[model samples]
Target: MTDFVQSARHTTEALRDLFEATPLQRNDHLSARYGAEIWLKREDLTPVRSYKLRGAFNAMRKMRAARPDLGHFVCASAGNHAQGMAYACRHFGVRGTIFMPVTTPQQKIDKTRTFGGAAIEIVLTGDYFDQTLAASQAYCRDQGAHFLSPFDDPDVIEGQASVAVEVLDQLGRAPDLVILPVGGGGLASGVTRYLRAAAPGTAFRFVEPAGGASLRAALEAGAPVTLPRINSFVDGAAVARLGTHTFDALKWADPAQVLLAPEDRICITMLEMLNVEGIVLEPAGALSVDVLPVLADEIRGKTVVCVTSGGNFDFERLPEVKERAQRYSGLKKYFILRMPQRPGALREFLNMLGPQDDITRFEYLKKSARNFGSVLIGIETKQAGQFALLAERMNEAGFAYRDITGDEALAEFLI
Candidate 1:
């Protein structure tokens, strides 16, 4: 075995003392839909409801053993990593300090505290993640404590390789393709390294949130480069830059193998998994599965494994997810209409609605002028093509209207 694979096996073996391996269950629903043997590596079912705990446990154990006097640990994270570190602190009975962005949700902070109990101190600082990370590192340096990186450390990468080890053992053979979700690239790097050494024939496809395509950018640049701006819709995997260590390990991957998933399109996958299969996945965790349709031809009749990375979704975001899915699928739209001030003008406009079209929202934006009034309307239809017909009817009737459904900037301000 290669050195990295050997080390990964050792880490996997050692991790058993903390928790049982996450399940690699064959998904009948997905298999039937795609004509493939589809398996979901349920990292969502882990103790922390994420695979992050594996890396935290493995790294802490190794660090404590090597430096017997190490008594404290520090880390900065907005979600999963914070919970993992908290659980590890409680498990090892060591003191830990966790730094989180001020904008992090209260639910995540509460859960982290619950997992860590009295073993951890939570520090809420900084408006953004970079600020929080820098603060955590400085605190660690000043206090002589070890700062635990979420994915940039070699030990953490080795620990994440355990996911691949479990998959190979549970399946009894290498999968034809392993679909991995990439953020800072710890899990992707580790899994690829281990699998490349142990089963060179296996293939890999890396998925990233389109709004935060850090890995794709790095591969294109031939090195890691911070994106000037990033959308935080997929909060779990919305990293601006790929980690240096992770990129080093994954530098050889084919640029074409990296796929970027639209953040709004991922909402469709999240809703499908929740409604049809009774499975809930956060946007980041659903990345691999979201790209399945794009790879339908290549994966037909092949054994495919998708790593469902995390399930830290809050029910409060359900409405937003549904709205995004509707917008992406063209089932919903918003338009501003100029209505004539004639006696039967309202009736004439109402008559333009097709049988399947339903008005979800209607409001008069302006009525000061007697000649015409502006109306803000939101319509939902059973079919996406209905919008084209509706537009044609509006044009033929000489009803002035502007569709603002796909206008991001305008929608943000008005919709």
Candidate 2:
């Protein structure tokens, strides 16, 4: 075996001291839906509820071994990475300073603190991850502490390769295809590299959030390039740019092999996994599975493994998740209607609704107008085609309405 692959195997064995191998379970629900033997590498079941712990633990262990005097480590993260680092710090009996964005969810912040306990200090700084990252790097330099990157380091990448080692050991053979969620590319790069050597015949598919497709961008540009803007809804994998080290490892990945899962569409996968399979997945965690439908033809009758990257979902976002899912699936819509100022006009609008159509939200943008008033309305229906029928009825009734469900600017402000 190559040195890296051998190191990865050793790392996987060493990790047994921390936690047993995460399950690689065949998901019947997904298998039936896709006509493929679908297995989920349940990284969500890790001690820190993420595969991130594997990389963090391996990196920290190697670092401490090289420099015993390195007593402190630092990292900047808004979610899973922070918790992973905290868990690793506590395990290694080394102090760690974690810098997180001020706007990070309380659940994540609390989890990081809980994982670190007395072994780490939390610093809430800046508003965005970039700002927090800058602060953390500066602090590391001043304190002469090692600043651990979440995915950009060789040791971290090698550590992440342990996931592939475990997968092969548990599955007893190579899967026909392995689907990986890509962020800064640590897990994807590591897993792909190891599997390429260990399971040379296995194919690979890379999934990235559409709003932050750093890997796709890199493949297109032939180098890592920063995105002009990134949507952070899929917080764990919403990277603006691919890591240099990670890109170097993944540079040969085919552009066609990378799939971009829309952020809103991921909500549908999250809800399905939660309601049907009783599995809760954060947005990034659902990426690989969410892209399965796109690869249905390619994977049919084959054994495919989708990495369930993390499960640190906060129940508070359930409503938003459902809303986004509905919107993306065309089961829900928002519209602005201009109504005549006449008694029973509201009743007329209500009568236009089909039996399956339900009004989820109704508001008056302008309740009092000389001749007409503007009404902001949200409708949920059992079928997507219901919207077309509703629009036709509104036109026949002489009602002027504008569908705002697909209007990004208006939806951002009003929806």
Candidate 3:
């Protein structure tokens, strides 16, 4: 092995002092379903419930070794990164200042506090992460404290490479394919870099949340480019732009190898894994597995390894996840009904419902309409096909209604 690969191996060995290596398990369910030998590198089972801890711990350790007197570090993150930094700081017995967006969930804030204990101080600032990041950097520079980047630093990237090192040692051989979930490109870059040297024949597929496809954008643009907007549903992996250091490592990646997972569709995978496999995965954690159906043809009979990146999901979001999954599968729907104000109209509308359909919501929007009233209605059905039959019956009964389930603007405003 070259110097970098050898160093990564040493780093993996050193990590044993902090925590045991995560499992690389053969998932029979996924294997059977995909017609391939599918294994999951369970980074979700890491001490911080993410691979972020590896980078955080490694960066902190290297910094401490170089500057023995360095006692303070700062980082900005809204989720996993903050928790990782906190955990690392506590391990190193160093002080850390973690900046989080003002809108971060209470559960995340509490978890970070728990991980750091007295070793870290959390400063909640700015409504957006960019603002929070800037504030943290400014504080670091002004105080002459070392700043820890979530994904940009070389030491952090090297730390992440340890994941690949463990994979090789555990699997005993390189799989034909490696599927990775991408955020700012740290894990993808680190893993791919090591694998290219260690397992030259292995292929790779990178998955990114559609709303935050920074890696794909960077590959296409020949550099990192900030997206105009990002959907934060996959909060752990929804980065607006790829990191410069990460991009440098991944510059040779082919755009075709990158796949995008829709935010809504990701929820379906999350629910399926939870219900069927008893595996609770956050949206970002499920990214590598969520794209299996799309790769079924190519991966048939091949050995595929998917990295389940993180499991820091809050159970409180279960309802929202279920709702999104239902909507994506067409099992749930919402509509605006224009109803006659006259008596018996309501009963007639109720009579048109299918036996397997349940009305979950019905609210009168304009009760004072002279001849007609507008009503907002939500319906849940046993099957997606039921909606077509329901629509046909509605038409036959002369009921005027508009399906607003897939209408983004109306759904946001009304539902």
lDDT against the true structure, per candidate, is 0.94, 0.94, 0.93
Q: What order do candidates take by TM-score, descending?
A: 2, 3, 1
Q: What TM-score does prediction 2 earn?
A: 0.99
- For model 2 the local lDDT of residue 352 reads 95
For model 3, how does the per-residue alpha-carbon lDDT over 200-259 read when each residue is reduced to its tens digit? 999999999999999999999999999998999999999999999999999988999999
How displaced is residue 253 in candidate 1, in Å? 1.0
RMSD of each: 1.2, 0.8, 1.0
Residue 227 of model 2 has an lDDT of 98
lDDT of 1 by residue, 152-187 (tens): 999999999999999999999999999999999999
Span of ten consecutive residues with least summed lDDT in model 2: 361-370
Q: CA lDDT of 21 in candidate 2?
A: 93
The sequence of per-residue lDDT tens digits that candidate 2 reaches over residues 1-415 is 4988999999998898889999999999999988999999999999999999988998899999999999899999988999999999999999999999999888889999999999999999998888999999999999999989999998899989988998898899999999999999999989999999989999999999999999999999999999999988898899999999999999989999999999899999999999999998999999999999899899999999999999999999999999999999999999999989999999999999999999998988996689999989999999999999999999999999999998999999988
What overall lDDT, based on C-alpha atoms, would model 1 receive against the true structure? 0.94
Error of 1 at 12 (Å): 1.1
In model 1, the Cα lDDT at residue 45 comes to 88
